[model samples]
Target: MRHSVRPRAAALAILLVPAVGIAATPLRIVAEDYPPFLRDTGKGLTGPYADAFRLLMRRQGVEVNYQTLPMKRVFQQVAMQPGTCALAVNYAPGEAETLIYVGKVAPITLTVYVRQTQSEPITNIEQLRSRPVGAINIAEIRDLLGTAGIAFTPVDRPALGIPMLNAGRFDAFISDTRPDVQFIGGRGRPVKAFTLARAERWVACHAAMAPATLAMLRRALREGVFAAETLPVWHSYGMDSFFLETRQQWLQPAN
Candidate 1:
C-alpha cells in the first residue's frame, strides 16, 4: 500500500506542474492597416509582415490574437499595455524606454511622390520645404520629417496622400510602402518618386511583457527558426531583394 501511495504521489506532482511552454495568456498583437505589410483581408490578416509574424509565433507554440487598429492607437496600446505588441514599427526616438524590440520584421524605404508636371528639382527631403507636403500620421514618418524641420499635413491613411496631392491640398506625398505609391500609378495623375529614407522595421512589445516570453522570441530569432518560412513570403511580395541578407544581424544575440 505504501508503494502504491508513492506511485500515485509522483503522478500528482507531474500533473501539478504547468505545461513548460504554454502561455498564461495569449499574446495580444496589434497593427495598423498598412497593405503588403499588414492588412485585414476580411478573412484574416494576410500580408507579408502578418505572415512572418504568425510564423514566428507558431514556431514558439505561443498563441496570439491579432487586431487591426488605427496607427496612433497601435502605438499607444503597445506602449502602455503589458503582453501587447505591434506588428511592424520603426524605432522612433524615445520609444526604447516603453517598448522592447523583439526582432526585425521588414525593410522600409520611405519615398516622396510629386506630380510629374512639377518643374521643381526636388532630389532631397529638404527641397520639399518650399512646398506643402503630406504624409501618413505615424510616428516614424513624423520623426523623419520633424528631424529635418520639415512640416507636413498629416492624413490618416496612404490612400489620402495621393488624393490630397492631386487636389492641390499637398504639393508632395511621402510614404514608406511601395505599393501605396504604385497604387495610384494607373488611376491617378502621373507622379515622380524619390527615395526619402530607409530603415528596418521591427516587432516591439511593452517592457512589462513576460521575460520568459521575450526571451523565447529572442531565442527563436537568434536560432533563425523563422527565416526559411518567412523569406518566401517576402519573395512573393517582390521583396526578396529587400529581405534577403547574407547575414541577418538581427539574428545575433545582443552583446
Candidate 2:
C-alpha cells in the first residue's frame, strides 16, 4: 500500500506542475490610441508598436494582450495597476519614478507651430508667455511647457488644436514632431509653416512595470526592432518620416 500511495502522489505532483507554471507567469500589455503608432482596428489592435511588440514578445516566449484607452487614462492606469505597462511615451523629467523606460523604440521630436501667414517666428517659449498656445490637456507637452514657464491654452485633443491654430483661434500649437506635419498635410493644410524645435524625443515605459519585463523590452529594442532597416514601413506613413530620420542620427555607428 505504501508503494502504491507513493507512485500516486508523484503522478499528482507532475500533473499540477505545468498548471502552476502557467499561472505564475503571463504577460499583459496596455496600449492607447495614438494613431499611426497604435490604433484599434475594431477587429483587433494594430499599429507600428503593436506589431513590433507582438514579434518581440513572441521571441521572448511571452504571450500578450493589448487594451486601448485615452492617452492620459492609459498612463494613469499603468501607474495605479500592478503588472501593467504603457508604451510609446517620451522620457520626461518628473516621470522617471512613475514609469520604467524599456528602451527607445523610436526617436521623436516635439515642435511648435503657428499659421504660415503669421508675421513673427516663435523663436523661444518666452515669446508665447502671454499668447494662447494650444496643447492637449494633461499631456507631456503641457508639462514641458509648464516647466519652461510658458503658459498655454489647453485643448481636448491634438486634432482640435491644429485646426484651431489654422483658424486663428490660438496664437500657436505644440505637437509631436511627426504627427503635426502628417496631420497637417493629410488635411491639405499648409505644411511649410511649421518648424522643428531644438528638443529631441525619447521613448519610455511605465515605471510600475516589473524590472524583468522592462529589461526584456530594453534588450529587444537594442536587438533592433526600432532599427532603420527593420521598420522601413514607417517611412511610407508621412508622420513617421521625422521619427525615421531622428532614429538614423541617434543610432548611427559612433565614429
Candidate 3:
C-alpha cells in the first residue's frame, strides 16, 4: 500500500498543487546514505539526489517522505514491501537483477582518495590490488573489485573511512568523488584522487508495486523531468554541472 501523506499538509498542498496526471497516492522513499547526494541528516533528508527525486515526484502528484537506510536494509525493504522504494541505487557491474528498476534517475562518480603526503599515487584497479582499501560494501563494486583481486574493508560510512585512510590504516578509500573530497577539505586533510568507475543510479521500486507505477516512472525518466530542477543543486556544491548534447538529450545527473 502507498504510505499516507500528512492529512493537514496534504490538504493544504492540494489546494495549491497545479494540475497533473492521475494522482498517485503518496509514498515514502528510502535511499542509500550517500552524502552530498543522498544524506541522512537525522532530522530528514537532503542533497542533490534527494532533492531531485522530491521535485519530480511532486510534479507527478506523488507526495514523498524521504529517509535513509543501509544498503542492505534498503534492498530488503524492496524485496518484502509492495509500495516501498529505495532511491539512488547504482547499476553495478555483474549484479543480479533484484528489484524492479523504475528509472535512470541519477549518476554518481566513484573515485579513489589518498592522503596528501603519500608519495605513490594509485591510478587504476591493478595498482590497488596489493593494498588494503576502504569502501562501502555496495554490490556494484564487489564484482569489479573481486575480478581485479583487490582488497578492501567495508566501512560504515564514507567519511569514517577518510580518517583511517589518512592515518594509514588503509591505503585509500573509494566513494563518490565530490563529496568525499569536500569532507576531507572541510577537515583540513589534504587528499589525492584517482579515477575509478562511474555508475548510473535509479529510484528502484519493490517488485510488488503496481505495474502502472513503474510505467509512470519510466515516462518521467524518458522525458527528463527533473533535469532542470537538479542542475542548480550540483552548482550549489561548486561542481561543474551540464547536460551534454547526446542523442537522448538527457541531463547528466551527476559528474
RMSD of each: 12.8, 13.5, 7.0
Most TM-score-accurate candidate: 3
Model 3 residue 161 lDDT score:
74
Worst 10 residues of 1 by lDDT: 1-10
**Per-residue lDDT of model 1, residues 1-255, tens digit only:** 000112233223323333347555778989887764576866566565666565566557675678888767887999888889887777765777878888766556677877666766678877888889998776778888888899988876777677777777877888765433234555465365688877777778898888888887776565232365556555545455545441254344442
User: Which residue pairs collide, candidate 2?
Assistant: 99-206, 99-207, 100-206, 100-207
Best by lDDT: 1
Residue 196 accuracy (lDDT) in model 2:
35
Give candidate 3's error at residue 226 in angstroms: 6.1
Per-residue lDDT tens digits for candidate 2, residues 66-135, read: 7877766766777777777666655565666786656656554556777767787776667878888776
Ranking by lDDT: 1, 3, 2
Clashing pairs in 1: none
* Collision count of model 2: 4
The candidate, 1 or 2, that scores higher on TM-score is 1
Query: Which of the two candidates, 2 or 3, achieves a greater lDDT against the reference?
Result: 3
lDDT of each: 0.67, 0.58, 0.63
lDDT of 3 by residue, 115-148 (tens): 7777987777788878888875676667567877
